[model samples]
Target: MSSAAPLLLSPKEVNLLKQSPTPISILDATWFMPNVARNATDEFLSKRIPGAQFLDLDDVASPHELGLKHMMPDQKKFSQACERLGVTPSSHVVLYDTHSVFSSPRALFMFRSFGHQNSSVINGGLPRWVHEGLPIERNSPSMIPSSHYEPPHFDARLIRDYQQIVENSKLDPQTNPDAEIVLDARAHGRYLGAVPEPRPELSSGHIPNSFSLPFNLFLQKQGTPDGEYTTFLPEQELRAALDNVVGAQYAEKIISGERPVVTSCGSGMTAGVLWLGLSLLGAKNIGLYDESWTGYAMRPSSKIVKTA
Candidate 1:
């Protein structure tokens, strides 16, 4: 990938949007947890980036039958949706949200999983944008006539389903494939079985054989009402922490190239935070466990092993 391909930018790069001549599109991807009373689409319509269009997480995702929320939709479905949204292969995409949250990165995960390379989440999202008093077009953006889009060759190797983790928990070395790595992005307490789950229907504890690297551990400080998230880790610190978690047998796969990680959280929200941090650290092979704890915890078929 070129140095310019996945342009993860700070406020500096963001301010250059209007100055650049080449086409750049920003996506207002604010979304809420499923249990929340507020809907993402409705919230977006109320206020958003000037000229920013909404990206519907549920509408654009694969059918949710796997017990996972918003898994990657099929290539044809993704392409068609992107085409309708004015997203093209070459367009540089800036994904953002109303709050300084992980919804922006979730959109990045979706587009990348389906083979869109030129997209990234704006650091701090709309909170920062608003704080800076950047122009925000609250009305709908002008839509272009749909364009022909080529879908990425389906990479089944990318996604990790619930059954696969269940299988990994039971099987010995022979059955444990080295091709993919499991990344649990839950809080350290949840991963260690120390804390109770946020959801009641699901049980506690993480998958056996999974490693705990809490997503918030990467965020320098949780953003305050008066401030947006200021990611604080030094480059060296980031490299050291990531090197340790990814140093197992999964090391080679991570070192080989980009796109080798699988992120999972209590449900699926924090996984995006983990994925975003991994991208900032320049880790390769990123993915998300869509079903996450929702699918694993209650499964009578799967085993949950707690590790320190």
Candidate 2:
């Protein structure tokens, strides 16, 4: 795989790559909420990209006693999972999900955190691929067992713990110039405490000083004769959205690498969308609060802010 791979690939680009002599390693990282009746694995088994393997989010995540979902796994565990999925150091890993841009970014985040930079996500995921008449197969791809892929140490710089977030919450950016910006990717209602969280045990509120920029804002819907599909917005429009959420000055600072950003969401899934958006804008200093609100709100020591 070329190290200079683009972070996002269109379905047309992906289709052309599949026809190459050495095709890319495509992963179906489709996942859904517990209440959703869909089974990602079963769906993948029935229909998926022609040469794609399934990446079970639950199987790769660390088992949390507190039930914090989608927590990053240890380097060894992650390395094993990738090897089992036939990913190698030279593989140009391409990730996609059944939903329109939902779960694939999280899987891409996991790859980047594990030091695999030679990877990309299908821009509109499987939905858009199907919408454009891309080839798919019901049978699983033939696996060429990876020769003990060694994952580099998990990038600590891309991850934030609960305590780190709490400390950040107490800082006033006005007082501390280096204070990081925290952005939540949950829905507006959930961020405002006006909508109940899907997790019954958790309350709906945001971390102090965190801005709510729903993950969907980064994507634009395109209506076709077949149906509607979602894809990332053009760069100019995305920059405008960022400027509107956090002033133009702050957005410029982030793009210039002078300011840092940490993204969070209900259980740390959609947070990747925020991280990916920032990265697309050329932001180098970005982190994911893996535990996110699920790990934060449950702790009595952490403070929660409710606008509604």
Candidate 3:
């Protein structure tokens, strides 16, 4: 297999890494949270999978936009970033991260947003990779200078902003042209207004007419190092969790032929995973609430936050 070959795999498929399959491009796409002190590129250069290369999230994003940290970059910057990483349009991207605990889903989003369908993250990320006893490399390859990686047309409508969420509420289904759905990715307590928020500045609780689907609940229970904080249920478990997560309120919206979804998280971070899961399951038209809870929560006039 060439480095451009596809590398999507499940835990069952992880054994192939031990054999050092050719043609597959594996990316050590590890990223740290904003609060975490370590730098990803420095860590990537220190050690990674045998043929694995570094895919910097910051580099992949729009450098021009200073307002939002890690918001998806525009197409020109996205194309250039991929090209710099030797990612041709034909490249099969497999992302691995230290925070399988978090960033893997974001990587999946970046790939899809760029219209590269042949990309998936390694389950449990690098920690799981090491757990499987796969080959590790310390030497950084001589930098492969970048080349052409053309991008598909920028799909502006594919993403939605805070104002869209407000507009969505006022849409009358019968008179409305196209309907939209909003998914709340906060914990159930926050969604239901039972618990206070992690971000103290924002008001607690979910947006109006939003479906509550806690992102952490999807984590595989066994894989998470911090059991209480994040849990990624396996495939079957995820489906089951989705049933519980996408409860009566949202299900009614979906069944009524309303639009599919636009996921919302505390500060627009974890909802990327919600969108990714929905996308993987064939939900064709979905977006993220870019301002998310922060947008609504911070606003005193917003009608949706229920204290009870």
Candidate 4:
């Protein structure tokens, strides 16, 4: 792993890294919706890329009293989790997921927020690796001693809390010039209150004034003998999707670091897809609403809008 390794690595590049003399850490950062029956760790134990360790998103998250899923952990907790996972400040952390592009980017964002800049996500993840006839193994990963990491303060610029999101929502361009555009990554139906949310207690609607750009628009599905698997869309398609939602001018500003963008979704999982798509375009000043709609809609103080 060179100092210049890309943030998004291909399956072939990962194969090359396997043969490299440089120290690299491969982590399977697979996570699924609560409604989904599959357990990510169990799936990892059943099959994974050779020498890959499980980086459970749930275990890395700080538990909420309101039962929110995958909230960002505190700095000490994150440091301990990374150390336990055998990651060091210098390690080229390679993130991948069982479900193509889903959870790996979230893990990447977590690493970046924790000031670990040497991490990258496998572009198509483990399914693509297996689809290319790459090797797989079921044996437990070899145990390595902890790195005893002392992490830097979490990057507040990369995250937006409920209070900040609410304040941003109320901003008028005439008064507050630095307000960020809020983008919701949930499906249109959910965003518009036409469909029920997965959580029975939560209502379907988006934060006021947020644009509805579904996360799936940033992905493509390729068919294999086993089944259809998801991967990111081409760079051109990603740009077009962003253009369609935010308009080409604003999209260009977002890519060029002139405008800020904050992404949100159901409990903040698929928001990572939006963040990763923007990153591919070399976008800057991006933030994630970690509490997202789950935290927003649960509070009576927050306003929700429905167009459907």
Top candidate when judged by TM-score against the true structure? 2
Cα lDDT tens digits, model 4, 1-308, are 12435779988898898798877889999999988999998999999988888998888889887788788898888888879988877788999999888889999888888777788999889989999989999887677888867866787789998889998888742245587888899999999999999987888998876889999999999999987778888899999999999889889888998888999999888899899899988998899999889899999878888889
| Winner by TM-score between candidate 3 and candidate 2 | 2
Q: Tens-digit lDDT track for model 1 on 163-202?
A: 7766655543324555355678877887887777777766
Better model by lDDT, 1 or 2?
2
Tens digits of per-residue lDDT, candidate 3, 85-129, equal 777776667777766656667767767766677776676666665
Runs in model 1 deviating more than 4 A are 1-4, 140-144, 170-181, 222-225, 230-234, 243-261, 306-308
Model 2 regions more than 4 Å off: 140-144
Question: Would you estimate the TM-scores of all the predictions?
Answer: 0.83, 0.96, 0.78, 0.95
Cα RMSD, each candidate: 3.7, 1.6, 4.5, 2.0
For all candidates in order, the CA lDDT equals: 0.69, 0.86, 0.65, 0.87
lDDT, candidate 3, equals 0.65
Could you tell me the TM-score of candidate 1?
Answer: 0.83
TM-score-based ranking, best first?
Answer: 2, 4, 1, 3
Clashing residue pairs, candidate 4? none
* Off by more than 4 A, model 3: 1-8, 11-23, 63-66, 170-179, 189-200, 223-234, 248-258, 295-304
Candidate 2 TM-score, C-alpha based: 0.96
- After TM-score superposition, the amount by which residue 252's alpha carbon in candidate 3 deviates from its true location, in angstroms, is 9.3
Candidate 2, poorest ten consecutive residues by summed lDDT: 139-148
